[model samples]
Target chain A: MSAADTILFVAAWLGLALLVAAFLLTVWRVVRGPTLPDRVVALDMLVGIVIGFIALIAIRTGFTLYIDIAIALGLVGFLATVAFARFILASKGRQGAGVYSAGAPLQDTAPAPDATHVAARGARGKSAAKSAKVAARTSGKTSAKKSPKSLPASPAVAELASVPAASPAIAPGKAAEEKPSAKSIGKPANKSASKTVSKSTSKTRSKSAEKTAGKAVTKPGKPAKGE
Target chain B: MDVVFAIFTAILILGGAAFALVAAIGLNRFPDVYSRMHAASKAGTVGSGLLLLAVGVHSGELSVLARALAGFFFFVLTAPVSAHLLAIAALKAGYSMSDKTVTNEME
Candidate 1:
């Protein structure tokens, strides 16, 4: 073997070891990460390193299979990243609870998915990740981040809305004629009476519940339509 | 020339192995997540480079050496990029880095 060849081979070997070390570090972070996105990101890094290793070792073994492995990994990894980003977006309380009337859109008054909202969501991920870490550290604050997703359904709110504070929302003429009794008292309009629910009340906002809320915000034209 | 080549490969492989072993140990030994990352990225980079180089020397064929060199270069470029991205992720995820570490003073 030539002196230069020896040097180059040595170089390749050292690179392999370093990449392994980096992979191990990434693995540690993946397991230790407090939130879903962090683990996802770490997984991405680990996959990238795997591709790099296959390519390096292929050079030594004189086989084409390794490079093929690298190519396959690249394609699969891209798909995984996109899917993860969507998952993260879907988890945030996008809308309110319950199914919308067929014509109603989400966030009636809130502006469309403009560049600004997109940027804000991106920014929100960063802060949310920070919050997740904080949540992990404190453990006690876990539920605080979960309450908004669990807000009462719009249908429930609407039922509460139509009812008067003291009685059910019956036709006004008939409701007046009926004498009130303890057994047949009117349904109280508790919906409007207590519009603001404490966000701190619920914290375990699972994936499905957030989706339900996101779908429930169906005010057609109002920007902040009860989403 | 032949004797020198053999000795060089021996040293290269041995050093590369030693670093790999240390990084493995560090993963278990380090108390915190950030310190473990440091041990892995820095030591792992050097160790892998040497191991690949050793392979190139052992293979001795022209085509093989050329390919090994490409891998070597790729490793050199990507190691630090991955490390930096990992660090960004670590910070963004909020695993507290060494408080005294000045690398991210701006943050």
Candidate 2:
């Protein structure tokens, strides 16, 4: 082979090796992450590494389509990160008790809203508590009153209320009540809440729940009649 | 001209690969998520940008160059934003930084 061809060949092999190593490191982070958000962040980095690999492949093979794939991967990766962040935020206390704490037995009651509220408030002070409370108020109204400031803790209460039960419709009403609060929280919160609302509403399959979720999603940033 | 271009491409690709390898090593060795993120975002973006530039140079086509440029810019823009968001989420979620990390910024 010519010198140029030889150089190209060597470069391709080197690039592949580097990318593979990077991928492995990212996977290690995913496996070793102490917290859920750490895992999410690692997963996001993995997506980026994969995009880099795709770009390298495109370079070696002269396929432009792979570049387009890299772009799509970036966009989708961003969306996934946002979704995961929202999930982490919404499901605050539940995850801390079940996943992060080492050797702790998973208790059904472990993710209590009060625990999460205290944790959120302790960790981030008033701002986080305010955000968490806003999130809670958007998810349900009954729990919203217990601690107007304890937003992060409200998810456990909401989840408990949402357990597939005879009164599935009741949970939706609570969720619907918080729709206006979601709109006020801004776009990311609105999108994440709508996504969660849709999922819960679909699972319950209550017509009123579906209607409420639909209306909340459509008229985002606008307070509905339920108030 | 061809020989010069080939030499430049080779150098760029090799250097980019080396940077990527270093980044991986750092990511694995860092004690905390914040530090790991720092290593990954900075080195990874630079490595990928260099590799894309190499590709653009090797192809010598305007379309390929343009695509590479776009990819480079996209990486530059997105990598920092993701890193920042991840850091914020981790902090909000109460993931403490490593004890060895001496910084008063977050406090």
lDDT: which candidate is best? 2
Q: At residue B62, give the lDDT of candidate 2.
A: 88
Q: Write the per-residue lDDT of candidate 2 for residues B37-103, one digit (tens) a residue.
A: 8777888778777777777888888888898789879878988887887777666654556658665
**Candidate 1 per-residue lDDT over residues B1-107, each given as its tens digit:** 66576666667666765665566556556654456556656665555556556556655667655655665566556556555555554444333443344565544
Per-model TM-score of chain B: 0.79, 0.94
Query: Distance from true position, residue A60, model 1, in Å?
Result: 8.7
Q: TM-scores, in order shown?
A: 0.41, 0.59
True contacts kept of 1: 0.01
Top-DockQ structure, candidate number? 2
Please list all clashing residue pairs in model 2, or write none if there are none: A113-A153, A132-A151, A133-A151
Off by over 4 Å in 2: A96-227, B105-107
Root mean square deviation (Cα) for candidate 2:
15.0
lDDT of 2 by residue, A1-227 (tens): 87877777787787788778878877876776655666776777677667667767876897866777777787798778777777766653233322111111111212335433433343244544544533342334443565555545556545644443422222434333453343232112122233453333322223223333233233322222333
CAPRI-wise, candidate 1 is incorrect
Give the count of colliding residue pairs in each prediction. 39, 3
Report DockQ per prediction, comma-separated.
0.07, 0.31
